[model samples]
Target: MARIAFILLCHKDPKAIIRQAEQLTAVGDYISIHFDARAPKDAYAMIRDALADNSNVTFARKRIRCGWGEWSLVQATLHAVEAAVEAFPRATHFYMVSGDCMAIKSAQYAHAVLDADDVDYIESFDFFESDWIKTGMKEERLIYRHWFNERNQKTLFYRSWWLQRRLGLERSVPADLQVMIGSQWWCLRRRTIEWILDFTRKRRDVMRFFRTTWIPDETFFQTLVRHLVPEPEIRTRTLTFLMFTDYGMPVTFYNDHYDLLLSQDYLFARKISPEAGQLKERLGRLYASDRTDFKISDEGRKLFQFLTGRGRIGRRFAPRFWETETSLGRERELMIIACKKWHVAKRLVGSIKHHTNLTAIDYLFNEEDTPLPDLGGIQTTLEKRTRHRRALMRMLFDYHETDRLIFCIDTANLDLMQDFFSDRSTTRLLEIACEFTDEYLAGHAKRVGLAGEETSDETLKQLLPTIRYDVVFEADRIRDAGFPNHGKIRERNTPEENAARIAEFLSVPEDTARSIAQTPYLFAD
Candidate 1:
């Protein structure tokens, strides 16, 4: 069997780290770990003891006090790689991972893919090519001289370090080296690793140059490997599924992310916190069935095929609705009224009548018993059948010919509806029904209350990254539009306050925005 050496750098989550080490252990494979020196001694001991019995697992003798965005991280990784190579001389490939990362695919699958490929799986891109840097901080990271404090903390020694370049006080990068930036995690062949080690050792100037660089871990190895290897020999994709919030931190995976996780082509996922209920156990169960051969089971193949759109399942479950021509020919703003219950839809229609000047709206219902107003009863076969929420949504987008379609969906259909509109190029908005207090929920019927709670959770997840704005119903805001007081209005931004926000977003008046924000229902009359 071809051997793979894993260099794991960890700071926290000892138990998960041990589990990852144990899971990755194979007959010929070697695991080398380097825990951050700054972490508690007992925590380090716990990790060390857990893997002490495993002969294939080795700990780095020289531990680096790993600091984020510092050279220490790169040094720690170097130490781990050196340890792994020293311990397992026969190792053909090296995989660098963090403690929070867990493999979603089988180890055999990884080995097979790697063995078949000759290219290094490291995502690298030129730093100067695009606006890859975050707002207002690009100059500080690339041009400034950020030094480490006595405690190994990143500190700005001179704020005007860019001026040094003008006066020739700046240290120039090596003429041979090109600045490359990429994801820190990568899988490289042993020869590549050795080349990196040799290059760093020989070029002390290059090492010193990157020492003052911001987040050099992302650039150091990337720059060296890209410079040494041919472009054809480097693959631009990593096998890790990492998501980031607006703040640039990894988004913690939760139970809701199970389908999303499995749908990805990546072999590993990161930042799986303990708060993500049952995810660790679930991943363990997945890895338990992993075989030495990379063959997937029939059921697993079906799922993979479904997610990749290679199967006939989508065609079989295709919606039965057909598109009808709109009378208002080329209207820019098209309001799509999506409701499950007839009563709510009718009330929404009434609200639209009271609020907006529009005489017609497109209404889509899933249930058969739900009545439609008599503009023309062009009932689709799906409207009479059992609820196929997603299918109906797909049909609505496919058939509706409009420039800008504003979907007015109840809380129950928000998630799936968002999924339908995810890939569309046209502009759209999702208005959610939010109840401010328990009193509002109590006032509504049982089903309505349940729907509100479900919508609230889905909206908070912000699953649809495409849609920029979503309207949330405020009790006080609706009260201005003649809605009864269901709960006490809090001091939060009311619908009136949100008028400027909506107007700026949609390019409409703050007063007309009240019609869209206040009218929870927009049923066809």
Candidate 2:
């Protein structure tokens, strides 16, 4: 009865994302993806393709910098919550995730945690009480003091001891203390959102001050909820669980193995890297009663559909000027950069599928010995799946000559399941999607999207702003933006190595038809 909502944030890494999405999708849940407003259209589109099977995931409209200590990041999150809650009012809890983040447990396990009628799965850090959160607040104050004195950014931190509170990031309720907590990346109830938003509208002053604070998100959310809520329902620990790393990439993971992380009793985490292929199976173990080494059903399929209804996806929301404003980009323009198969991509995809014209899909790695053709199942070969998951993700994200598109996934999906295609939909309508003949989609009667996403909504000009983008990233680089920060670029292989490649990658000539410098969406003069 408790509907699960996964909020997946995308920056780079397509193949890894798809694999993880598929795995997560196997478990039914509401899914939504918040591509960094600045992420390339192609990069965003590739993520869409990965969720083609389901009809709940949709692209978000808010485009703000998701820096570690900026109001812009908090703004993006609040806005994203606004969109998701509007679409899935019935949703019981929302899980904040990153492009690289993955669920070590099955959706069911998580569902149980959230669905447990008695316990409210709210991931909050009562800053007033939390030592870690208090540290962050102290850090904010110290930094602001230094910045104000040296940098003269005094007006920014003028309010109180908690700089984030004064900067408009925190809710100034009861008193003016800024509510601080984990980066708002956690599982929470629908009521919590309603209360927070309402709190914001009422306390405009406190909210306004947070806009200039250092770690707005962490400080703001924690401070507000702790102050407002009675008896503090949040887990005091830092995180509930985690993948190999909070940073999105590809690697191995297991719910049991990561139990220590989960032991924190916290609900959210940041860095994560999991083999795309094993997502469903690995995650399944976390919740489902069924246990096996590798199987898709374990991924959370039944739960996925329960959260994101197919009918919701068919109804199109008015497209923003920006989506149509930019030129249709070149094919394969988004490919050759970023990998996927990380994080449980399904939950995010499911959320988006609900609001878009894009078609949601569940692409299972077809292997022998499974009972059903389109049911949930994980991969028999984890190693090979991981290697190929990335390769195939490139194919999905990269544009081809004919369609000149990365595989276009349609219909906003609540979540995309990767483990195994379900034998059939629980409902009758999902069986017949616009282009798909599958029983589940057909029964749902959801509209499918483009043959594929040829061009992305965002142009090359805007491609940062999701997470601490300025930080040294070991991910891809834009060879040229056709402007000031343009041309002859080299790409960093990993997020950790991103900064080092900046100078070299930016200088590679694009005119040469071919160069180490890869082409982003070619811009119009």
Candidate 3:
């Protein structure tokens, strides 16, 4: 039997972390945990006592006071890796994950996949070539020296960023090292882990340089793996499912995400909370079962249809068609709009109403048979009724100036919209997608409503391409924009928490912010 070593980095939630440990406990397996040094000593003791019975579980002799966006995270991970390898020298594969992550697939299945491939599973992309980081923040993170205190709080020693730029005081990233960044979660072969340990020990300068960089955990391993491993030996896909909210927080998985979780080919899902004990139990039982394969279930397929408006089993529902030619006449600075779904459209419009002064535009694909509710500052227009969604999108493109700001209401038409507007350099596009759990169920209902007896392969091929979206929104940007609902459907931030974020972002009174957030639409005076 091939032995697997799991290195878990845990900060808070001891109960949840211990539960994760229990699930992975098995013969020929080793679990090495590195608890954040900042956590209460009692909490660490509690976890230690809980795992006392498991001979496979061990703790890192060294723990770092881990801080977010700091080099401490990288140090902690390295420590866990070192400890795991030391304890279980015969381990074939090393898997690193957060304490909140749980295995979606059986351990046997995970081992089988690894056994079939000699390659490493890690996601990496060249920093300069990708838009992973925000436009201007890349330089700030890589070049400037950032220091954190014992509390893991960043200190602002230099107020004048412009002064530092003029003086050229910032250090350049190592010229010999090609900077790569990606998700921190990864599973590496034993030989690869050994090589990384050896390389980092010899390269003190590299280690020191990364210590001063922002979020070094994400970059350090990616850069080293890319530099050392042969291209054929590396698999660029991570085996974890992590959805980020506009606010930069990982979306917490709940019972509602069961279908979405099943839909993914990933072996593990992250940031599950203790409150979802039932969900955890269910997943554990499912993972223990031998019959469950790595294929999407029927419910998962229905969800896929609901989300992207594809895979309708029987019905051939056309994109809602409405005929109206209402242009802004003159190009406006910003316009928000949605596709056929009115409920989604209204909510999106409401989220941005108070934050921005731009008016909302509704692009109806279907005829306006029923009257719509009062969406303040939101105007409705008929998208040219056509069999092809691309044709109607082309009409919208023709109507708006290339430089106008357009907020897409949902992600269903994201693919078609991106292709149509790809060449329009000046057009600013911000797409809003609803992430509520019930929304998926609702989508399933809609799919049933539009069901037909047969959907031809040609129809699916045409429909699937148009409905897919290529755009990915960052959680931080979405949170900054005051969008209420994002990330996991079950773990929504409280209204008060959302209001505070809006108040801070827009510099408004808390009460005023709460009022604005209450209505999904801006109230017309």
Candidate 4:
């Protein structure tokens, strides 16, 4: 019977904010909102009037003019938490989120996740030991006083820092306390929140030190919580889904990214576009629905890995050389099946399936099942689709458990061929040459009245040499019967001996390799 009290820090979008409050209140949870003092008075009034009838909603007593990388953001959050705690004393836990944040899953799912553990969910890592902050200032954020707003007053902010550096001016933190850093978002138990609030009220000197520290919101509670709560009671991970761009701005989710968002295991996601009305509505319905089967799909994980993990700029080389350099996670291993015809792919897939534990996905580049009509135009749609497919291929390589994978691709989907071969570290490829000679291919293209085939053929021919692979199956030699699926696959090898060529390359079990070699496989177009 764990009850959660939500504290939302909102500035604008009164309508969206009202809807968010309504959705949370409808499910028996209490929410407190802190509207920024700088926002229009009418926006704040509208949000208040909309939630006037709901007893579960309340507004903070004071609204602070919050700024990015400033102390006021944490002050606003504190006001919201104070209001929520005072209003709802029985609340077991407190969840802090921004106005644009939405519930990706049901409320019960969150309760279920939290009820199993009495630990606090907040990202707290040693500021000195951990490389939590990705780019820009690091230890300098704490050492030098950051008086100007980093976002609005970029020039003054830098100038102040330079002046401080030139003068050799450095601030001293409390010797007893170790600084910590993490994402500002968190879900903490009431006891933890109460302890943090109490600690802040009593420790004026420590608070004064943090007020001048850069991005205090990310460090304040993170450092204080570690001081108040025991290590065993704390779980250093944020329950919120937060992804940042290379420039360190949080990624804004749009309507077209619905599928990608659904693929994550996070309970809530933030920084949604204000214009994403459709996405907001759909997620609302999903939150209210009694659906229990929430799963993280392979496609979703792959998309996440691509966007946040492997696809990030400069990540590929940094972590390999620098011990302090960090990455999202490991990329998966991949193997590709490039075939001339569908039947040849089918034969190879079946042989591999019979021999190994690997699962072969047939025609992965087929048209996407869901239509993204809102994304606009044919070109835009194609671009999004291509991006998603690339993410999928990358995700597959990161699936570390199953090392071997077979995917079927024909000349029709040559658009994705280059993308699949982009990452060389985790990819093992096999190619199946066309059965027909160049002259025969040209004649066939003419007879079929399909000129596009000639273009695709040339594209494949030119692309194949540039791509790296472990083996290639000659169409001429494989035309005869009794072709072994496993054997020694060298640059110079005859097809006279029935062999398990791919199995040999993959080094599968001997018994499985024998089964693959002995199996009579027929290839059709």
lDDT by residue for model 1 (1-525), tens? 446788899888787778878877843467899999988889889998888889889988898787777788888999999899888888888888887776676666667778787879887888777556665455456555556532343243343454565676655567887788788889899899999889889989888888888778878888999988889899987878776655677767776655445445666788677776477677655655555432221122222232233222122333324322112223343344443333544554565456544443334434433443332234444333223443333334345543444444443443333334333233234232332343333223224221222233332233222111211322122334331211221124466754554454345566776665465433212
Native-referenced Cα lDDT, model 3: 0.63
Give the CA lDDT, 0 to 100, for residue 50 in model 1.
Answer: 83
Lowest summed lDDT across 10 adjacent residues in model 4 is found at 315-324
Best by lDDT: 4
Question: Per-residue lDDT of 293-354 in model 3, one digit per residue for the tens?
Answer: 55533233343334443333222333333212322223433333432344654554555565
lDDT of each structure?
A: 0.59, 0.42, 0.63, 0.69
Query: lDDT tens digits, residues 1-525, model 2?
Result: 667667776666777666555555555566666667666878767777767666666556676645445576678777777777877777787767776565544454556556554333434554455564422245444234222321244454454445554664533333546455554555667787788889889988777666655666666666666666664466543333432222333233333324322323333334443543343344434543332222111112221232233224331223334332332333322101111211112322233234323333332232223222221222345333333342333333332222211121211211121100111211111111111123322222221221112212221112112111311121222111112212222222332232223223222223322321122311101
lDDT digits (tens) for residues 1-525 of candidate 4: 678889898788788889998888777888999999999999999998889989899889998898888999988999999999899988898998888899888888777888989999889999988888767799888889999998889999999999999999998888878888888889999999999889888999888889899999989999989988999999998888877665767778888666556556677888789889899998888767766566553233233443353223231122122222322224544566656555656676788786677867666554344222233232144344444554444345344335556677654343344444444435555555544444544443334332222233433343233221211223322232222231223222333232455655555766665565444544323
RMSD to the hidden true structure, all candidates = 15.3, 26.5, 17.0, 16.1
Q: Candidates sorted by lDDT, descending order?
A: 4, 3, 1, 2
Model 3 regions lying over 4 Å from their true place: 149-163, 297-525
TM-score of each: 0.57, 0.44, 0.60, 0.63
